[model samples]
Target: MKRWWATVPEIAEDVRDALAAGDDIHAIRMLMDGINALPAAQKAGTLDDALNAPDTTGDPRWDALLAGALRYRLHQIGEHAPSWTFKEPLEKGWWPFAYSPSDAYNDMAHTPAELMRLGIFLDEREFTQA
Candidate 1:
């Protein structure tokens, strides 16, 4: 199956850059809303299974940052946005309903290790544009 959160590093970098450049919630809102509207979901998995997945990637910082981004975005919206919801391709556990990627992202426990392996942390300074 294809990995959904795989693209998060690049997208997160963009979000981080926007946040650092004095972009308020409204600006962040626009960014999030716009991205969420895309045909492809940048991140994947249902809220249930994704939330329960192990962090085999061995990098806590990576997991923390990914989780923080999702949670922060949720806070901005006050609730689940319809565009953020989706279904997990492979059924793992006892989940009957599909989950929102937003929910999966918000859940700290489920941030995949693959997200960390992508080298998103290598250049934190690059996110801060002049």
Candidate 2:
């Protein structure tokens, strides 16, 4: 029989709490695991949830980057960005997880155009961008 499930907002909430506590790594873990657990979720729906998730950690950079990265993914799949995406400003710094300068460069070389514009360099794309 097929499994039953809905959107995974729990993952977003978990990420929000983790980020609020300054535990971004844990937040990314939650994001990756959630996507892995529900890999077949409608891509558009998942991206929509991401765009609206992450309510605010009082950190504009993070808030906006998350929205932009998710929105970038939506654009990649040919979906329209939710109107609220413009509310997120383009952050100026690389996201908090950058391990080194070279890593950031490598990431930037491959980051999609929209995310680059939003300034989400050096992301954990394998999962967080999923």
What C-alpha RMSD separates each model from the true structure?
16.0, 4.2
Worst 10 residues of 2 by lDDT: 1-10
Model 1 local distance difference test score:
0.34
TM-scores, all candidates, are 0.25, 0.65
Residue-level lDDT of model 2, residues 7-98, one tens digit each, is 33465567678887989878767655554544344533444443344456455765565556555655655667667666444536565565
Candidate 1, which segments miss by more than 4 Å at Cα? 1-54, 80-130
> How many residue pairs clash in all the candidates, one count each?
1, 0
- Please provide, for model 1 over 1-130, each residue's C-alpha lDDT reduced to its tens digit, 9 standing for 90 to 100: 4544323334445545555575544333433443342223323333323323223223233234344334444334343423332222222221111156554434323322322233222122211221
After superposing candidate 2 on the true structure, give the runs of residues whose Cα lies further than 4 Å from its correct spot: 1-12, 32-39, 43-54, 128-130
lDDT of residue 98 for candidate 2: 59
What TM-score number comes out for model 1?
A: 0.25
Error of 1 at 17 (Å): 22
lDDT against the true structure, per candidate, is: 0.34, 0.57
